[model samples]
Target: MKNIKSLLLLLIITSFGFSSCQKDIVFVEGSGPGGTKPTTYTTKMSAKVDGVLVECEFAYAQQYTNPDGTKDIQIYGIKSAQSFILDFQNFKGVGTYNAADLISSGTYVSGVNDPFNNGHYAESGTIKVTTYNSKVIIGTFEFKAVNTIGEIKTITEGQFVISLEPIPGPTPGNTTTNITAKVDGVATDFTGQAAYVKSTLIGNVMTIVGTNGVKAITIAIYNYKGSGTYEIDIDAQGSYNEDQSQTGSYATENGVKTGKLIITSATSNTIKGTFEFTAPNMVSSLSTKKTITEGKFDMSYTTTTM
Candidate 1:
């Protein structure tokens, strides 16, 4: 999840523009589940383009708390650069809203394609709020949107379950001063005697990078901020900063040496984790695979927002 925070920020601006809006809208419901209620927040959207059925999966969820005591639910579905955004203002009970009703409220903005100046508008559609609580929101939506060039796209089967509660922070734990591991059966250590270990946690992802002289290793865990084992995301996991891009550098590979990130503990200001990976030389001609094992880290971090 590289630059995910940036991506979400852009999405907030292009999708809803919460800050520039008018009076707030609030959605609230009592606790406990009713009969036949869903247990999760899930969403999907699809349509037919050029006689081919194209489905866009729900990609992200964001909730904006307004100063006027109102809230906005922002859901995004993406199929390539083309996308759709559904904004539910003051999302309350199980109610149906048509295009006119939603537009009149000025809290609704449903559209397709790029959401910038060149975006499209939904000519007609309905948004339904099935159920909601402080923890989750469940809803369904459909729209017939057209672009400025007079291109029409029908979006259907749109639904989502967005979690609204805050994520739990890590517990209290001791901090270690060094990171120890082995590279291809050779002992490797980063005692923090020369350089400090740097760590950053944003959303559910945590990234850590350490160095010793010219050798550096980076480890990242996605969809994770708690104690658990996670398989590396091959495309955006970690890298070995050696080789100086000569013959290319090395990356964590799935097979051959298989990579793993194990987070033992976490807190708002501290994190502890272990990792291992079979770093493959990006340049295929370089046959050496750096095996990093028994890797460990315990570091403190600070939070920053943009």
Candidate 2:
């Protein structure tokens, strides 16, 4: 019994000695998602406010999928944001805003800041970010509006380069194609498709250039009135130049129209919805809302193990 007791005491002391001799440990790792991360992503975002062209950048170390199955972006509910300064031909500084001034302010909408009663901005409109990039070729860091005396103007549907970061690479999707524009019952000419689109994980922005005469259309998705589900809107160049003319023009097919796209359909690699060329106008003049009836777009996505 004494030997057993002694041995027990010895074991306890030995354990205490060993525990006291232990040292801290750590391990180094690779940057970002580590080496096992996927090279591509299936991305989507939403923005409110119709009849305007907004330019913003996105940066994210990760990506997300909304409950409604829509893709995710860095931020949403963009009231007024810009990415370039040179494009500010008509861009007036919304009153006097400092950087990061109105961030997270509130849900901004058209004519919200209009003191002029012109149904447009009463002063220089505010964008979340007002900066420039390598591919901006032209334009200022101002909000764009259709037929407004404000500094903001509309962008024809051609693709413009925004800033983004390059990953190792992505499984190249069709990056190039021609799409038809339908406003009401008129079929417009094919302008071009988004090409050379690179994703910037930092800013969470997707930058693309137009090809074969493709116009850049802003596909915005946002959660409004609820979560998961979103409201989608597309801003193109203009409407069918002569709505009644049998022949359509690129200007007509690729400009921003007063319309919204309700994402009624979605898939792993594609999103389908209604395209109404005239929305605000339909809401006012025709006492009607226009829907593309059979308009759809196929986009590519990359999913990874988060």
Candidate 3:
């Protein structure tokens, strides 16, 4: 269940990152030379859970291709601490999928605990795909899920519009990539012609760097998994370099005790998250410290093989 939650968080973050910059590609369902665009068509998700309204502020879908050529589509809707997830395995085009078939399932997470244990898992449900293509998917669903305690949550009036266009990674010299944060309560923006952002994945470790042509921020994760909160220790590290000449400040064993990296989403080509750390100056003569807070990054990446 922990792994399930982590994977869901990862998918949500990745969907948010892709939706932020590539919202321009609009797909008019059934539109042609004489067809009128429908006003209700938009990328969103809304439903009723246990007779209460749940209009998700964040929604997205992901498709995975299996080794045997079968496909799976997972839809997610998140609102604060609540989330609704629907999964359809061995997906075939536009059709109706029933939970009784064992190829489809739905989950409703109402709190921080595992949905299957504390929340709910679909006991009966049906998902109907209305429109589907290489770039877009339209669907509706309803289900009744029961938790380990026998409490049931009924979900209905669910609908969603998911985009499937690929999101491209930042180019090596692209200065428009963004990474922002606060240094001691001062806003610091890294973008435009003054900044450069990049990431590299080698084996199970991933390193991310952002520079403003002068100062720089670097974060390294030793055992890179999908999405979750990571502590700054020997496994995870962060550093802030003020200039090219100094040894900089680091969130290492010799530094202060507070530091964390929260990865909201991560994939083979993209990553998004928040971070903060407190570090003492590496130079022994200087007793100064550097504190970074409210740090955030959303950018594509490249990978290097072993």
Clashing pairs in 1: 41-161, 42-160, 42-161, 43-159, 43-160, 170-266, 170-267
Candidate 2 lDDT at 240 equals 24
Best by TM-score: 3
Q: Order candidates by TM-score, high to low.
A: 3, 1, 2
**lDDT tens digits by residue: candidate 3, 183-216:** 7788776641111112232225566666665566
Taking every candidate in turn, the Cα RMSD to the unseen true structure, in Å, is 18.6, 25.7, 15.2
Estimated TM-score for each candidate: 0.38, 0.25, 0.52
Over 217-301, each residue of candidate 2 has an lDDT whose tens digit, in order, gives 2332311221123222323222222221112222212234444445455554344444443432211222333333234444433
Ranking by lDDT: 3, 1, 2
Worst 10 residues of 2 by lDDT: 202-211
RMSD of 1: 18.6
For each candidate, the alpha-carbon lDDT, in order, equals: 0.52, 0.27, 0.65
What lDDT is obtained when candidate 2 is compared to the true structure? 0.27
| Each model's total of backbone clashes | 7, 45, 0
